[model samples]
Target: MNSIKPKFINVLFSSRLIEVLEFILEEPKTKKEIEKTLKISTSHLAQVLSKMVDMGLVDKRGDIVKILPKGEFILGVNRVAKGYDEFLSRFGNFMNTYILDDIPEWLISRFYELAEIEIAERREDVFSPHPEFFEHLSNSKRIYGYVTVFFKECINFFLRLAEEGREMEIIVNKGVLDKIVENFTEGFGKGIERKNVRFYVSKKDFQVFFYCYRCFLFDILLFKKCFFLTTRKIFFANLGWVIVPNSKSFIKAIKKYAPDKLEEVIK
Candidate 1:
């Protein structure tokens, strides 16, 4: 009589089989030892061991049971599957907001480096960034940004940083550049002349903001489409900021997306 072949999925899903394989993978063990560690009934253990041996996943030498090379390979695959499962679970909420393509390949590959993600709605608080975001700006020695608008406080912060010898290079909206000149012409004028800060105006209208620093990065996304928050009120859109700490890769990403050599393209 020929030995029956075990269904692969059924054997893979069998808790006792997995538990026994995991244990045996560590070291060869006798049936009595496995029973003591797993607390599985003798009959069930026998059945699972038989199926695994038939599938060429386990080898029994006298009383000692050890996982075969095939079994180790399967376990390695399972380990990878488990890691992806956990990664998906952790970032599921973020996925619901945007499709996979929206995320850059480099960032996606280094998803484990994510420090924080924030979404702020206008209804909740308009133009309000977290306190920590300001701290990052204050401490930065160099700043590069692609920006659309600025709050009064933000402009003031940049001015102070510039005074403290921080170098700022920004690609900004025309209105924002005009506002900075209008509000602080003398200070900004000196900063520009002294090469402490430089601004390039963009012709294309864009609302998203991106900033890169030595060890910090900010990605601020603003939605300004025909979406509505309510029947009477048109949706002003939320700002989604992803803050990354220890941002060497993030700096690279920012440079790639918002090139500093954008003077020729400035309109």
Candidate 2:
């Protein structure tokens, strides 16, 4: 219906309108109830509702404000736009270094599922992970991620998780698999040889590192811990955060990158 035409930009920024529509999306609402629930003054809400009607997004059937089909369309558009906006607002700095090309379209449309993102960074040492991240992660029973940068310590850290009986799956590009076999020759052959740890090698090269546990999803920056692997230039990843702990959004993205399609790395 061309609901996301140029003029829709204004609709995306109308927080009051978004709030009203989201509140009443399932049903209709009375004017007084909206004003009270939104804590908006009568005069302000009057103006907001008036604007909504003028845009043909809503209709006043007596005292109740009802969303029109057009309004539903606008709200849906705003939801997707809001997802991209939130994602960029959080990781915009990585644009120069990383690209989202590896991520597929079906998943990008559902980015809003990642709720309440909180950033946790490691300020003391760029080479190490934040201690608190490890603490929170200890409670998780399963861990899986796509790693582009190969660090023996990082590999060992995850190996320990497997040793402790936590199920582990580490996906990587061929570049990394080669390096692990080449560099950690003796150790890789022995430890990850356990049935608990499974590795996958992707057919495509991915710059963005994606990680998640059963507890939370984490989009991580690479830590500069090795150059022995294929000479792929890597940025130091000293920052990572909980992405809506226990949220389903990242599971989709993690699945998009990992799964039955990739080659399993067998020791």
Best by lDDT: 2
**Winner by TM-score:** 2
lDDT score, candidate 1, position 234: 12
Which 10 residues in a row give candidate 2 its minimum summed lDDT?
A: 226-235
1-267 per-residue lDDT for model 1 (tens digits): 998876576655566777888999988999999998899888988888888899999998778898999898777666555555665775565456545454544444444333223332333124555656676766666665555445656666667777788766556666667778788878777666546665566554445344343333344222221111111211112233333434434435444656652442221
Residue 241's lDDT in candidate 2 = 27
Backbone clashes (count) for model 2: 1
Single out the weakest 10-residue window by summed lDDT for candidate 1. Answer: 226-235
Query: Could you tally the backbone clashes for each prediction?
Result: 0, 1
lDDT of each: 0.58, 0.61
